[model samples]
Target: MLIDALQCGNFDREVFEELKAGGFTCVTPTLGFWEGTLESLDELGRWRDREREYPDLIKIVRKAEDIRAAEREGKVGVLLGYQNTNLLEDRIAYVELFADLGVRVLQLTYNNQNELGGSCYEEHDSGLARFGREVVREMNRTGIVIDCSHVGDKTTLDVIEYSQKPVAITHANADSLFPHKRNKTDPVLKALSQTGGVIGCAAYRNITPADACATVDAWCEMVARTVEIAGIDHVGLGTDYSHKTGPNHLDWMRKGRWTRGVQYGAGSAAVPGKVAKPDWLVNIGALNSVEGGLRRVGFDEGDIAKIMGGNWLRLYEDVFG
Candidate 1:
């Protein structure tokens, strides 16, 4: 039941081939982070064309049951999601509009702060604003899974406490294991787990850094530690496997019309480009390696099933109701 919570890579033939080969049930890819309404609509249109082109290989997941159904059909389920509410343009009604359009997941903020709330990169965590609270309610009402991957710590906590349904940190690691601004702190993990929310443990190079020295074993150990903090049922895969991203994708991701200047987020001026994925996660089949590593770290098949995708399905069933 392999389900990756997030993958912002280019959705090309090779990537979809890898997914089919890897036996992936579903993958939630970012449709928009900072794109405005029109651009977001274009993103959806591009995906619609791509899905039609590969009719046998890809199926857009409009519901949670569609994920399992895609696996049965031997196809990869595509869950359209966004990393920011900027496209909403302060319109509360747009939540239902996008949900009706089959956008199942919506992150509150991106790298920088906006109308919804603050981001992890912001110096001051203003917590959830009044509009942010309203947005949460609308998302809950419309059956969109609220994501807090790039959201500020304060805002995330506020959201977890305030939201009627569970909220997810779609793709990020635990700060206790690999302390980074992008990683979730112990408090955030506790809050998420207690509320039956899941944190998709990222296997991105910068966050996991599963290099020659660190190795896949170390990465799995990190996952084990995260499970200890976030609980086994509250952890899942969010590999952030960026395959075939263009040279300017990072520019648009970090600085999406909000700034004329360059914002080299997570990267420096010296290496202002997309960060490399861990060598072990080069393809979808590498998920087997992750399962093996987790076994070595003492996770049984049932618990691992929860981590891989079962818990996410449960959350979807609860929220996508």
Candidate 2:
């Protein structure tokens, strides 16, 4: 089965190896979120060196061609993305720099207001700021896909209307099914679909409806609801797998210097509590790995193929190419 996974936090060699072993042809692994300029540069440098050292297990992917090539070679194509624009550090030039370094998808904000705009958890969403408009334009010019999963309602709408290219909300749920701040409302879904953007349904336990049991079938049902609202063409899977992040990581995310400093407002309150064990959190393992989950949901091969990675593939090609 095809899987477009997003791995957050520090990269683990063994975990990535397992993804390849388990049949993940392409994955969008995040490298920056709440990272400062210097830190991001250092991380990029390290990633560059690692890619050079381990060319077989992972290779940087920029275009749709790279993904196709990876599939042919039986290797996992690593598409670099960012969960937040912190690395931009109020500088628009960084967008191009990141694009050049193989970062393709960029989420505008995390959980609170930044220079770009308000986050999904923010109490008052004032939409995209002046600087955010410039950032969006620059991203379009650089061929980087914009993501709005964690952005506030107003900001998300503003971005959908403003972007010259189709933008994605890399990971989110339907708020109509589960009334959480992290989930997108019906109007937001319609607007996103209207723009030809894709909404990747996430699989976090907290984000799904509390009434819905925490299982692969339940998650698929939630995704079905999203498809009903946004249409199948605009929906895909983006399992925000924090498979290796423990309680310490959650605490870091909640109280980290990056989040505390920039993400202020009621939006920050929506962030989930830290998981005690990294394994306890959602990962491909939750569905007994990617292929298992698809089968459990009774998804036919074609439906599974589209939701697994085909939709994301089409969306990426349209925006990046």
Which candidate has the highest lDDT of all? 1
- Could you tell me which 10 consecutive residues in candidate 1 have the lowest summed lDDT? 206-215
Residue pairs in collision within model 2: 119-152, 120-151, 120-152, 121-267, 122-267
> Which residue runs of candidate 2 sit more than 4 Å off their true CA positions?
210-213, 258-272, 276-300
> Which of the numbered candidates is closest to the native, going by highest TM-score?
1
For candidate 2, the TM-score is 0.88
Q: Each candidate's TM vs. the true structure?
A: 0.96, 0.88
Estimate the lDDT of model 2: 0.76
| lDDT of residue 296 for candidate 2 | 71
**Model 1, span 167-240: residue lDDT tens:** 99989998877777888999999999999899998877666644421466777888888898989889988877
**Which residue ranges in model 1 land beyond 4 Å of their true spot?**
209-214, 269-271
How far residue 48's Cα lies from its native spot in candidate 1, in Å, is: 1.8
